[model samples]
Target: MALSVIGAGFGRTGTLSLKFALEQLGLSPCHHMMEVFANPEQAPVWLSAARGETVDWDSLLSGYKASVDWPSCHFWRELAAHYPEAKVILSTRDPQQWYKSISGTIFPAMAGGLPEEGPQRDMLTMVRHIVSDKVFSGATDQAHVLDVLARHEAEVKRSIPAERLLVFDVAESWEPLCRFLGVPVPDTPFPRTNSSEEFQARLS
Candidate 1:
């Protein structure tokens, strides 16, 4: 399908659950960060694209009908321009809650897991700078967290077309999401996976 959907939301913002939900809504085979992990060999190709090096968009997104999370969110503005018919879903949550989640799960993974001196490293750093604090180095307080959330909200609103953009709160579950995708609601609540505690336990 030519109809691309970009989930330009940070981690701990329901990106994974949305991936499954979108697939259920017929946009199968979505690209996500976890997929990148599963196929670490493909890191170079994606890293090149993230670095603003030219790439065949269609070829890069070979089987993906949609994409969610980190690197995807980073390139959303460009993706929207490339695919005019695409939909952009900015997943969100309470700023404080999001801050807690990131401090507890995401930042630790990024800082310790990803390398700091290669294409993948540069790409990840770029996304982190755009989405979170580049200077603070894992600081998540009331002011900084709110700042991140607000900036994310503002930038997405200003950059994307109204008709194509949907600000989604995962707490609301499947109704709004299904409606946005023009699909019937499934007989299921959104699946929650990868909790903050779970992430910590896995990494530890």
Candidate 2:
């Protein structure tokens, strides 16, 4: 199935929660970085894409109705063009908090190397190429990283048609998202997950 929702937001910007929220809104099978970790077969395909090679987006993302966060977010432009009908979600947060969250969670995680070679290792490698090098330009300084985040958000807003994009913050919850997708808001509370502490605990 083709993607109906494409997330242009970087990781640590409430993407994990957005994944669940989207699924709850009937967009199940949302793709996230964690999906690659859970499925080894998907790693190499992403690694290939990370290296700047053209890929069959459909084959790679087959069965997924939506995508969010890293790896996918890194290729948002391509995915947007490929799935023209898909609406873009630019998930965001306070700039300083976004920096702090990534600093505490994903930054150190990607800085370390896996002990042995495997699919997960390959996945980390792809992430490093995309997140560490390409996205952040290999600089983790507060100034630089925050700048990248701001520029990314601005670019998404500029490139995607205003009508087709929703600048979302998970804190705002389901109404905005539900309204954007033309779906009824669930009676259930929005999914709020993957906080910095939880992310650190998982890595530990």
Candidate 3:
């Protein structure tokens, strides 16, 4: 299935919640970094893309109805171009809070020194290459990271047409997202998940 939504948000920006929210809105099978861990074979494809290799976007994301978080987020431009009809969602949060979330969760996990010879390691390496090296330029300073975040948000806002892009914050909940996607809000509450504590626990 073609992607109906392309998430240009970095990981830890409530992306996990957004994944569940989109799925509930009928955009099921949303891809996230967790998907790469679950489907090991997909790692090399993303790794290749991270290394600037050509990839078949359609085949790479064949079963996903939407995509979010890292790996996919890193390739938003390509995905948006490939799936012209797909709407882009730039998920964001307070830059300071976002840095805290990542520094405590993903950054530590990436630096946790997990075994170097497994699917998880491969996935982490790919994320490091795309997010750390490419996006943040191997710098972890608060100022630098926040600058990258701001710059990315600005770039997305400038690049995508107003009608085709939604700058979303998961905290805003259902209404805007529902309206943007032309879907009714669900009867249940929006998903709130994968907090820093939860992410830390998973790594342990």
Writing each residue's lDDT as its tens digit, candidate 2 over 15-103 gives 99999999888889999988888886887888788788889999999999999998899999999999999999999999999999999
- Once fitted onto the true fold, the runs of candidate 2 whose alpha carbons sit more than 4 angstroms away are none
**Stretches of candidate 3 above 4 Å error?**
112-114
Question: Where does model 1 exceed 4 Å of error?
Answer: 1-3, 113-142
List the pairs of residues colliding in candidate 3. Answer: none
lDDT of 2: 0.92
Question: Which is superior by lDDT, 1 or 2?
Answer: 2
Q: What does candidate 1's lDDT look like per residue over 1-204, in tens digits?
A: 554798888777878888888887788888787776665555666566655688676776778899988666777777888888889999998877887888878666666455757656754655455445433335656587667668867999998888888899888888998888787999977867777877788768
TM-score of 3: 0.97
Name the 10 consecutive residues with the lowest summed lDDT in model 3. 107-116
